[model samples]
Target: MGNWKLEVGRMAMYMSFPVVLFHYFNQPTYFEEWVTKTKRNIFPPENPQDKEAIQQLIKDMRTKQIQQFEGE
Candidate 1:
C-alpha cells in the first residue's frame, strides 16, 4: 500500500511537470496582460492630473531615447 501510494505520487508529479513548464513559459505574457488590464481598470487617464503625469512620463521616455541614440 505504501509503495502504491509512492507510485501514485510519482505519477502525479510526472504528469504535472509538463503543465507546470507550460504555465511557467506562458507566465510572462499572462502577467503582462493582467497588469495592463488591471492598470487600465484602476487608473484611467481621463482626468487632468492623470493626463499630465502620462505626458510627463512620455516626455521622460523620449528624452532618454534621444540621449541613448545620440550616445550610440
Candidate 2:
C-alpha cells in the first residue's frame, strides 16, 4: 500500500509538471521575448535586401497578431 501511494504521488507530480510548465512559458512577456529572440537567431538579416524582407515579415506578423487578439 505504501508503494502504491508513492507511485500515485509520483504520477500526480508528473502530470502537474506539464501544466506548471505551460503556465510559466505561456506568460505573454516570456513568450514574446522568446519568440523575438528565436526569430533573430534563426533569421538574422544579412544585407539590405534581407533586412527589408525581415521588416516586412515582422510587420505582417504584428498585424496578424493584433487582429487575432482584437478578435478574441
**Could you tell me which 10 consecutive residues in candidate 1 have the lowest summed lDDT?**
25-34
Tell how far residue 58 is off in model 1, in angstroms: 0.4
Q: Which ten residues in a row have the lowest lDDT in candidate 2?
A: 25-34
Task: Pull out the clashing pairs in model 2.
Answer: none
Off by over 4 Å in 2: 33-72
> Which residue pairs show collisions in model 1?
none
Cα lDDT of all candidates, in order? 0.91, 0.92
Candidate 1 achieves a global lDDT of 0.91
For model 1, the stretches where C-alpha displacement exceeds 4 angstroms are 1-45
TM-score of each: 0.38, 0.40
Query: Which tens-of-lDDT digit does each residue in 1-72 have in candidate 1?
Result: 578889999999999999999989787875898889899999875998888999999999999999999999
